[model samples]
Target chain A: MVVKVYGPDYGSTKGVLLCLIEKEVEFETVHVDGFKGEHKQPEYLKMQPFGLFPVVQDGDYVLYESRAILRYFAEKYKNQGTDLLGKTVEDRGLVEQWLDVEAHNFTPPIYSLVKIYFASVLEGVPADPKAIKENEEKIEKYLDIYEKRLSQTKYLAGDFFSLADLNHLPFTSYLMNEMEKGFMVRERKHVSAWWDDISSRPSWKKVLQDYKNPYDVLKEMNLVN
Target chain B: MVVKVYGPDYGSTKGVLLCLIEKEVEFETVHVDGFKGEHKQPEYLKMQPFGLFPVVQDGDYVLYESRAILRYFAEKYKNQGTDLLGKTVEDRGLVEQWLDVEAHNFTPPIYSLVKIYFASVLEGVPADPKAIKENEEKIEKYLDIYEKRLSQTKYLAGDFFSLADLNHLPFTSYLMNEMEKGFMVRERKHVSAWWDDISSRPSWKKVLQDYKNPYDVLKEMNLVN
Candidate 1:
């Protein structure tokens, strides 16, 4: 049975979509429109108690948390399309370590920035300049660490592109393209190259081509003009 | 050779210590005093660029990120001591899912509370009541979800006690015992029980008996009254 993924077509859902495509796993998306509060509906909440995006149902097994879903498909189909988890135990350890780094360090600041920049646009409230500046500083400090690490290794985990690097896609895309913070990536030489390399991957390209971002969906629904 | 863990004996370092003990892996501590800015030194930055607590060195392989270290040792010693990563792919997926939840949803607010509550105690500054209240509400909301999940299963991932459950030890202990927020755990029946159950594990008991918290070290160093 093809896996059924329930969520909007953007954000973390796109991360999961990119992973599935890379792993050559067959899956279909069941959109739960967050703008409409459909994710908070009891039916959707059954799969994801927190009513978060991108819950995957593979046969009798169900899972949420996009990173975990990415790991699941990567591990389940290790040899098929992409070698995501890496080959050895040590490599896998580094991958897991950097994955946590992305979760704890990288995503938070970028997520805050996204909320400050984009959510303000949506909610019609003025963004707090102080909070935005603080978040940018945090991101710069973190990316400096990444810049150093990426100088040594081609990717965050190692030379191979693992889930650690892949995990940064959704929010970093917001940082780079949508939020007008591309300099955060472009200012650092190795990081800029790394972003270009990973973002241009065929899998990510295919995801971009197929799925509409959340804002686009809102425009289509006449929720935002 | 016994693994060498570099960091102080508290906070995230203790999480790795708990995992090592549970897995029956022999290890020694090399304290990097954060209060003294030792973690930010050039040599320590070589291992962990971000200068975070608890970087583990198992022979030549050095790894940081407390959760990742837990997963690493858990995988390496899977057949020896406690089985943490679960038995099958689906089980492992669930374990990874809850681990992410603990990292993303659970830890952030609790961490913020820790900094707000405990850091104030250390810095001799007045704790911000508004920020504390906000963090408390965030933690309470996340715990409500955990309460529902724990009501169904003995642990976060499943009936088996896995890393997902174990990862809650460090901060939750601070919240429960030290930070005077025991009511957060005590308020939720299932979550309170879950906390009691996980906290009573012999491995955690040993960690508490063996290690000193940062404040204790500060007092010993004549840095704090």
Candidate 2:
């Protein structure tokens, strides 16, 4: 099946691309630059009302939200490739549970850590030390929980490497590489091992090779004013 | 089948209760007061390591996160009552897409608005107008999208009321009733109509009639400090 993905090259976009690759899906891309207001235009809004991306259109059926799109692809092509969800109902529950953890728990703190500390520098604003300190404590607490979970099981859902683990790649990669917080992952042995396992997956490697870093583009444009 | 849910009488907790009621599933609850740190105890952490709740234990299996618990109960009891997910692959995808919207898009801004204003008052701090103004704008934009979508379909996922629609109940009710922002929902005609239709469901009405508000308990106990 042919799929059309609309988004700029960003962290959220990589998650969908990685899902597509894992499923061995063929797809074309239509880049919609947020800075250019392309994503906010009426046409893009028709497909993705939230004005975020990447949105996937397989013929007339369209879906958005990176994790939701990943899930749609995984469920649609469950038999064609590696099963990323799980094999049983309980496993499915665990997978959904951890995915919710990633969305509701893991993401917000790390994102604030990034925005308050690093992205603010990109925008030529002084970093808020108090904000950074508070967010660091929050992120540390979240990762401590991750460490315990990873120590108990090989992956977030369980022994299997599921979407629960895969969903963390994009943001964690940004934290380790761009934000230079490798210690955040590395200090926790189980989390580090878990990261090493998932990040080394062929699909994730493909995501690394194919997807461009938005931060690098922002740097090149020298848009910090 | 008997299910036991562990959580306080908060918004997230009600989402699971509503789901169970909708599915015609029998469940009992053990209230875990967040103000008392009961949720963070070793016993509660064993069932839900994240220390947040609406965790449901059915026989031997346990699940957490209100939405995940809802999905588990819905799937396990799909044949017993109303189907809360969807019938086909496309429908399931749609349901998931909107569920993510509620999780990632709709919930965050509303929660932030609550924390910034009312919850801050609980901490003896004046509400920051700047943060409130920003978050209110964000909430407005998100609700506009919801309005447009509800105008097109009878519910978030489609004409049928699914978990996606049900998930909005707890937070929307809090915003409308507790926060006195009923105007936010009432202002958009289609959204207002959709709310009227879904909130009128016997299941949701029961949730309102039975579940106690955490804020009320906190007020009674003078625990806000």
Best by TM-score: 1
Give the per-residue lDDT digits (tens) of candidate 1, residues A1-225.
999988988888998998998889899999888878999999988889888888999999999999899999999898999899999889999999999898888888888877675576667779999999999999999999989898999998899999998888988988888678999899999999999999999999888889988667657766566
* Residue pairs in clash, model 1: none
Q: Which lDDT tens digits does candidate 1 get at residues B1-225? A: 899999999988888999998999999999888878999999999999888988999999999999899888998888999999999999999999999898888888888877775576667778888898988888998898998998999999999999999889988998887677899899899999998899999999999999997657757867657
What lDDT does the true structure give each of the candidates? 0.89, 0.84
* DockQ of each two-chain model: 0.81, 0.72
Clashing pairs in 2: none
What does candidate 2's lDDT look like per residue over A31-137, in tens digits?
89876889889999888987887899999998888877888888989997778889988898899998889888887777787667545655567888888787778
Which stretches of candidate 2 lie above 4 Å from their native place?
Answer: A222-225, B116-121, B222-225
Give one digit per residue, the lDDT tens place, for model 2 in B108-173.
877887777556655668788888788778878889988889888989888888999999988888
Best by lDDT: 1
